[model samples]
Target: MEMVRELASKKAAVIFTKSSCCMCHSIKALFYELGASPTVHELDQDANGREIEWALRSLGCNPAVPAVFIGGQFVGSAKDVISLHLDGSLKQMLINAKAIWF
Candidate 1:
């Protein structure tokens, strides 16, 4: 409902990750466990991944694997995501994404 509406109103959420990146997989797994499936933009596969890497770097963030964004807001890397979950803030984020939680 509200979360789905908010996600639909946004442009897109991109996740920059590589195949061997453990943090990338962890974030994806966490999202799955939370029931919020995000659109991943794998930097290792997309031809424009380099450009995305550049964009993230320009934002004063290191071009690291598992970078995330929702509604164009930078959400940081996998450790950041885990911290959000551990701190109980991830629920709000999932709510905004219209995710059906367990």
Candidate 2:
């Protein structure tokens, strides 16, 4: 949990992902399309992968991978992000976090 928190806080936009996860890819693409240069942590490629997955689960990320943190705050998974996008709030959040210039 501490490690996750520390990593999340290091960037304005952070995404915890798994290489083979399609939803993770989609979420990353979404951020890229929005012009936010997010820090991506691939759980499958990390030594503490399993532990971080467990920690993210504790943080309310049920599936763990694709967990997003914006401005050091948990913003949830793909569905949550897509919802935010649909509601036109995701861009505002990114702007507020200074993740995207516009």
Candidate 3:
């Protein structure tokens, strides 16, 4: 969890993912399309991947991979992100975090 906190806060927007996950790819694309550069951590490719995955699960991320943090806060998974986008809040969050500019 500490490592998650450290890594998540390293940038305005962060996404913990696995290289092969399609959902992860979509979410990353969403951020990019919105003009936000997010810090992406590919757990499956990291040395502490397994442990970090455990921490994400413990933090309530179920299947985990696409865990997202915005403004250094644990926001949620792909569904949540899509919901936020539909409601027009995701863009606001990106702006607030300075991950995107108006």
How do all models score by TM-score?
0.76, 0.98, 0.98
Q: Specify the poorest-scoring 10-residue window by lDDT in model 3.
A: 59-68
lDDT, candidate 2, residue 56? 99
Q: Each candidate: what lDDT?
A: 0.67, 0.97, 0.95
Per-residue alpha-carbon lDDT of model 1 for 6-93, expressed as tens digits? 3324734446677778888888788767767677767788786676666666655564678776555677777777798899987677
TM-score for candidate 1, residues paired by index: 0.76
Predicted candidate 2 versus true structure: per-residue lDDT over 3-62, tens digit per residue: 999999999999999999999999999999999999999999999999999999999898
Considering only N, C-alpha and C atoms within 3 Å, which residue pairs clash in candidate 2?
Answer: none
Clashes in model 3: which pairs?
Answer: none
Candidate 2 global lDDT: 0.97
In angstroms, how far off is 65's CA in candidate 1?
Answer: 1.7
**How far does residue 96 in candidate 3 sit from its true spot (Å)?**
0.4
Which digits, one per residue and each the tens of the lDDT, describe model 3 over residues 7-89? 99989999999999999999999999999989999999999999999999998999897999999999999999999999999
Tell me how far the alpha carbon of residue 73 in candidate 2 is from the true structure, in angstroms, after superposition.
0.2
**Which sections of candidate 2 miss by over 4 Å?**
none
Model 2 is weakest, by summed lDDT over 10 consecutive residues, at: 57-66
